[model samples]
Structure formats: structure tokens, C-alpha cells
Target: MRIHHDWKGLSPEARGATVAMGNFDGVHLGHRSVIDAARAAADAPLGVITFEPHPREFFQPDAPAFRLMNAESRANRLGRLGVDHLYELPFDAVLAGLAPEDFAREVLVDGLGIRHVTVGADFCFGRKRSGNAQTLTQLGRELGFGVTVAPLIGDGRNEYSSTAIREALADGRTRDAERMLGHWHRLDGEVVHGDKRGRDLGYPTANMAVGGLHLPRFGIYAVLIDVLTGPERGGYTGVANLGVRPMFGENRPNFETHVFDFKADLYGEHVSVALVEFLRPEMKFDSIDALIAQMDQDSAKARAILEAR
Candidate 1:
């Protein structure tokens, strides 16, 4: 799919599309319903309009990391869903200041030339979120386009939403998160140099920094690693530690994965690690020997869990 960073000077073919609009963080089942609504609304090309840096990140700069997927991951997933075009609008001071009607007129009508637009029933837009699905419908009627407000999708209990997915990940419930997301929760980053403590302990690892990615519970987990852009280029089962190495006196959080029965130089390679199951909470051990013994047990348990899958 073609990703457009700005709406200005879009080609004729890029405009006049049926758009699904929202944050679309995880691209979960609920978000798919909105996209499906857009596809059903028009014969025009299917497109998605999402914010860059997320509006929540812009509004609450000091908030904890809560993104389920980064921009690159989200775009790739949307492409896999058959999106022909993706508009990643900047969520800067100017766009955030737009009033309700001005946003609808400038962005939806004149800028995108949208033939139809779809959004979740609870979607809100404009400065201070003063607009709703009803406002968009009214604007579409006046602007000569169509609007669809997708109803909330749920199992008559909890609705499918990014918030619910985040909660599950935060609690180390990868299966629950996957059930809502329709895929395993993954962390994507470039492998970087580390302290080599794992190597000294006889378990070498490929290390990656979790800078802005939403951290799952700090624990040992069974993971499946995919080498996205290197010679390895395949999935590998592994055990990973997703936390600060309290035993080593480290403070910053990172991912350290030991690919089972495999050794490869992964430095500078982009890899995705999918959390399969949480093994145990990260803990501090008194002696190196004790830590190594526990790691052995963790590795064995992870191997059993992954092999059984």
C-alpha cells in the first residue's frame, strides 16, 4: 500500500477514496469492522487515515508507554488487510488546533476528496474532541459524500478495543491479547549491542532496545523470533527476557532473546519477537550461579511450552 504522510498535493487517484479513520493502533477486529464498512460503502479505492505519533502521545507527553504497535508495524498490518492508501496525518500544533467543522471541511472534504468515510460509533475528532459520528454524518450530507458509523463489536460482554489489548499485555496475558488482536502481540526493533552478560553466563542473546514500544510485564517469556530483513529470514523459537536485568544492576528496559540451538550475528538486523507465553516474573538473584541455574530452568520450561505448540 502507498503511504502518504501529508494530504497536500495528492495525486488525482489518491483522492476521492473511501476512508477508514481513527488511531488504528493495533488494527484489531473492531478497527477491521470500520475498514470493512468503508469498503462496503463505496466502489472507490479503500484508504485509511490515522494520526502519526498518536494524538494521545501528543496530548500527554509524560504518559507511560501505551502504544500496542509502532507506525511501521501498523502500516504493514494495514497493507496486509488490503488497504490501497494510508494517510498518516501529522498530529502537530496546527492540526490539533483545528475546530470540529474546519477539520471535517478541510481534511475530509477538500484535502482527501473522500467519496465516503467510516468510523467507529464512538469516534470523536476536532479540537478537544468536540465532534462525533453524528457531526461527521451531517458534514458528509452537506459536502456531498457518505458517512458510515460502525457499531461497537463485542461478545456481549467486553468490546474489542486497543485498551483491552493493552490491559491484557500489561498483565502478561498474551493469549487474551492475541484473541482480541487476531494475531500475536509482537515487538519489532533492530538488534543492538548489549553488555554481553548473557554470553558470559553461557547463554548468548540478541539484544534490542524497547525504547517506545509498550512493554509487556517484566518477565521471562516464550517467544517466536522472526528475522525480518537479514539472511536468517525465518522464524525461530526462543526464550526472552523483557525487562531491566536486575541481576546485572541495569535500569533501562530491553529485550534479550536466546534463540534455541541457534547462533547467528544479528547485530543491525531488524527482528520481530512475538510473545507466546509468560513464564515468570523478573526477579533478582543473590549469586551468579543461582541465576544461571534458574535461567536453565526457564529455558527448559520455555522449550517445553513452545515445542508443544
Candidate 2:
């Protein structure tokens, strides 16, 4: 997919696409429903209009890291969904200052040249959040473009939403999150060098930082790994620890994943780790041998869980 940073002065190729506009944090089922509406709205190109730094992050800089995925991961997901154009517009001071009509006229109509736009029923825009789906529909009437407002979606008991997914993840309900997400919850980043404690323990792991992402339950997990870059690019099943290393002396959180029966130097390579099932919370063992024994049990259990799928 082609990603455009700026909304202005597009090549003819980038203009006049039917696009879904939202933060699309998790790209969950609800978000996909909106995107699907955009696709069915017109025969034009399929595009997604989202914000970098997420408008929430832009407005509340001091807030906690709650994003499900970073920009790279979002782009990767959109590409897999066959998005024709990705307009990741900057959420800056100038853009934030626009009034409702100004944003609809400047960004959607004139700048993006979008043939149609789809947003959720709750979507809002403009200074002080004055615009809603109804407001956009009215603006579309005047501006000669189509507007679609996708209704809320949910399972029987609860809504399919980012907040719901976060709650499920925080509670260590991996399958619950996946049901809402339409896929496993994944953390994407580069493999960074670690202290090699796992290597010494005979379980060499690929370490990834959990920067700015919402923390899932602090536990061991059965994971599906995608080595996204470098020569080792492929899929693998493994076990992972997604918490601060309690055995070692560290307070920062990260994911340490040991690919089953695999040997590859993965430092600096980009990868995506999907949490399949939560096994247990991390614990500090008194002896190294005890920890290794527990790890063996964890790996065996993880393999069984993955194999069953």
C-alpha cells in the first residue's frame, strides 16, 4: 500500500479514494466494519485516513501509553487488508485548530480529494470536537462528496471496541480479546539486544521493547511469531514472557520470546509477536535450575496449545 503523510497536493493517483477515517487504534472488528463500509460506498480506491501520534496522544501528551499498535503495525495491518492509499495525516497544532467546516472543506474535500468518506457513528472532528457523523453528512451534501456513518458493532454480551479489548487483555483473557479483535493481539517492533540471560539458560530469546503500548497481563504466553524483516523472515510458534524480568533485576517491560527448535540471530530485525494464550504470571524462583524447569513446562504447554489450533 502507498502511504502519504501529507493530505495536500496529491498525485492524481492518491486523490478521489473512498476512505475510512478514525484513530483505528486496534483495527478491531468495529474499525474493520467502518473500513468495509467505505469499500462498499464506492468503486473508487480503498483508503484509510488516520492520525499519527493519535489525536488523543497529541492532546493529552502526559497520558499513559494505551495504543494497541504503533504506526508501523497499523500500516502493516492496512497493507494486509489491501488498502490502496493510507493517508496518515499529521495531528499537529495547525490541524487541530481547524473549525468543523474548515476541516471538512480543507482536509476531506480540497486536500484529500476523497470521493467518499466513512466514519463511525461516534466520530467527531474540528476544534473542540464540534463535528459528528451527522455534521459530516451535512457537509458532504454541500461539498459534493458522499458520507457514510457505520453503526456500532458488538457481540451479544459486550461491544467490540478498543476499550473492551484492552480490558480483556489486562484481565489476561486472550481469547476474549481475539474474538473482539478478529485476530490475535500482536506487539510489533525490532529485536533488540538483551543481557542474554535466556541464552545462558538454554532458551535464547528475541527481545522486543514494549514502548508506548498498553501492557497486557504480566505473564507468560503462547505466541505466534512473524520475523518481519531480514533473512529470518518467516512464521514460528513459541512461548513468551511479557513483563518486567522478575528473575533478573529490571523494572522496564518487554517481550522475551523463544522460538521453538529454531536458531537464528535476530537482533535488529523487525518482528510481530501475537499473544495466543496466557499461561501464567511471571515469578522469581529462588534457584536458576527451578526457573529452567518451569520454563520447560511452560514451553511444553505452549506447544500443545498451539498444536491444537
Candidate 3:
């Protein structure tokens, strides 16, 4: 998929796309429904209009990290959903200052020349959030474009939303989060070199930093791993520890996965690890032997859970 970073200029082909517009943080089921509406709206290119750094992040820099997925992960998911163009417009003071009608006139009409736009029913836009779905529709009619406000989706009980997914993840309800997400809750990052403690313990790991994200429960989980880059790009089932290494005196959380039956060196490779089940909460072992024994148990449980899939 083609990713455009700005809306200022465009070749004819990149403009006039029937696009889904929003933050698209996780590209969860609700986000997908809006995208589907856009795809089904017209025969133009399938596009996603989103902002970099997310508006919330920009406006509230001191707030705790609450994003479900990072930009790279979000892009990969959107590409997999068959997006032809991703207009990842920069979010900044100038963009934020645009009035509702000016945003519709400048960004949507003149800047992008979008043929149609599909947004969720609760979508709001412009400076100080002065616009709503109804505002966009009226603007679309006056500005010569089509607009679709997709109704919110629910799973009989709870609405499919990022907030609900975050709540489920925070409680270690991986299955519940997956139900709302329509996929496993995943963390994607490049494998970086670590302390090699897992290696010395006979359970080698690929470690990834988990800063600037809404963390799940600190625990061990049965995970499905996808090696997204380099020569060993493929799928693997593994047991992952998604927490700070309390035994090692580390306070920053990291994702450390031991790919079962795999012997590839994965440093610097991008991998996506999907949390399938929460096996246990984080705990420190008094001795290396005890940790190894618990790791063995975790591996066995993970294998059984994944194999059953």
C-alpha cells in the first residue's frame, strides 16, 4: 500500500479516493466497519485518512500512554486490510487550528479532493472538536463529495471499541479483547539485544521494548508470533513474558518471547506477537532452577493452547 505523509499535494491518482477517515488506532472491528463502508461506497481507490502521533497524543503530551497500537503496527494492519493509500497527515498546530468548515474545505475538498469519506457515527473533527458526523455530512453536500457515517457495532453485550479493548487487556482478558478486536491483541516491535539471561537459563528470547503503549497485565502469555522481516519471516507459537524482569531489577516493561522449537537469531527483526492467553502473572523466582521449572510449565501450557488452535 502507498502511504502519503501529507495532504498538501497529490498526483491525480492519489486524490479522489473513497476513504475512511479517523485515528484508526488499532484498526479494530469498528474501525474496519467504517473502512468497509468506504470500500463499498464507490469504485475509487481504497484509502485511509489518519493523523500521525494521534490528536490526543499531540494535545496531551504529558498523559500516560494509552495507544493500543503504534503507527507501524497500525499501518501494517491497514495494509493487510487492502488499503490502497494511507494519508497519514501530520498532526500539528497548523493542522489543529483549522476550523471545521476550513478543514472540510481545505483538507478534504481542495487538499485531498476525496471522492467520499466514511467515518464512525461518533466521529468529531476540527479545532476544539467543533464538528460531528452531521457536520461532515452537511459540509460534504455543500462541498461536492459523499459522506457516510457508519453505525457503531456491538457484540450483543458491549460495544466494539478501543476503550473496551483496553479495559479487557488491562485485566488480562486477552480473549475478551480479541472478541472486540476481531483478532488477537498484539504487540509489534523490532527484536533488540537483551541481557542474555534467558539464554543462560536455556530459554533464549527475542526482546522488545514496550514504551509508549498501554500495557497489558504484567504476565506470561501464550502467544502467536509472526516474524515480519528478514530471512526468517513466518509464524511461530511461543510463550512470552510481557513485563519488567523483576528478578533482574528492571523497571521498564519489555516483551520477551521464547519461540518454541525455533533456533533463528532474530535480533533487529520486526515481529508481531499476539497474546492468546494469560497463563500467569509476573513473579520473581528465588533461584535459577525455580525459574527454569516455571518456564518449562509455561512452555507446555502455551504449546497445548496453541496446538488446540
RMSD of each: 1.9, 1.0, 1.0
Q: Tell me the TM-score of each prediction against the true structure.
A: 0.92, 0.98, 0.98
Count of clashes, each model: 0, 0, 0
lDDT of 1 by residue, 66-160 (tens): 89888877887898799999999999998999987899889888899999999999999999999999999998898888999999897579999
Task: List clashing residue pairs in candidate 3.
Answer: none
Tens-digit lDDT string for candidate 2 (1-309): 999999888999899999999999989999999999999999999999999989989999999989999998888888878899999999999999999999999999899899999999999999989989999999999999999999989987766889989999999999999999898999888899998989999999999888888999999999999999999899999999999888887798988999998987999999998999999998999999999999999999999999999
Cα lDDT of model 3 overall? 0.93
lDDT of 1: 0.91
Cα misplacement distance, residue 240 of candidate 3 (Å): 0.5
Model 3 lDDT tens row, 98-168:
99999999999898999999999999999999999999999999999999999999888877889988899
Tell me model 2's lDDT, rounded to 2 decimals: 0.93
- For model 1, state the Cα shift of residue 220 in Å: 0.7
Candidate 1 Cα misplacement greater than 4 A, ranges:
none
Error of 2 at 105 (Å): 1.4
lDDT on C-alpha atoms for all candidate structures: 0.91, 0.93, 0.93
